[model samples]
Target: MPQGPLFLARAVYRRRRLRDAARLLPVFGLLLLLLPAFGEQSGNLAHTAIYLFAVWALLILAACLLAPALSRSEAEGDPETDQGPQDMGDS
Candidate 1:
C-alpha cells in the first residue's frame, strides 16, 4: 500500500518537472536560501541564494541566446537520448 502511493507521488512530481522546469528553479533556489538560515547569527544562506540566482539567471540567458544552435544539435543527434553526460544540457 505505501509503496504504491509513493510511486504515484514520485511519478506525479516527475511529470510536473518535465512540464515546467523553469517554475521549479526559483522554488529550489528559495529552499536552498531559507533552509540553512535557521540558527546562528548573520544569514549566510541569503548570500548562497544570491549566488545561485546569479548562476541560474546567467545559464537561462545563455541558453536563450543559443537556442537555435542548441535545438539544431538536439534535433540532429538528440544527445541525451543517445549520448552520455554531455547530453544532460539538452531540453
Candidate 2:
C-alpha cells in the first residue's frame, strides 16, 4: 500500500473515532443514570413489563450511541486507541 492515502485514511479514522466517542460518552452516562430507577421492584406484572421496556429502551438508546463508537474502532483498527483528555478548546 502507498504511504499517502494510508496516512490520510488513518487521520480520518482518528477524527471519526473522536467524534463518535464524543457523542456516546454522555448517553452512556445517561444509561448509568437510569440504574437507580431500575431497582424499585413491585410484584405487579404491568409494572414489571414497564420496567422491562424501560430497561430495554435504555439499552437500545445506549446501543445507538455506541454504534458509531464501535464502528469507529472497527474502521480505525484495534479498539485499544488512546482516550486522552477531552479537548475543551475544540468543543
Query: How do the predictions measure up, each by TM-score?
Result: 0.30, 0.40
Candidate 2 structure quality by residue, lDDT tens digits, 1-91: 2233334566556666666776766676677656656766556768766766886787778668777766766676643245555555753
Off by over 4 Å in 1: 1-43, 71-91
What is residue 35's positional error in candidate 1, in angstroms? 17
Displacement of the residue 16 alpha carbon in candidate 2, Å: 16
RMSD for each of the candidates: 13.7, 10.0
In model 1, pairs of residues that clash are none
lDDT of each: 0.55, 0.64
> Looking at model 1, how many pairs of residues clash?
0
Task: Provide the lDDT at 49 for model 1.
Answer: 75
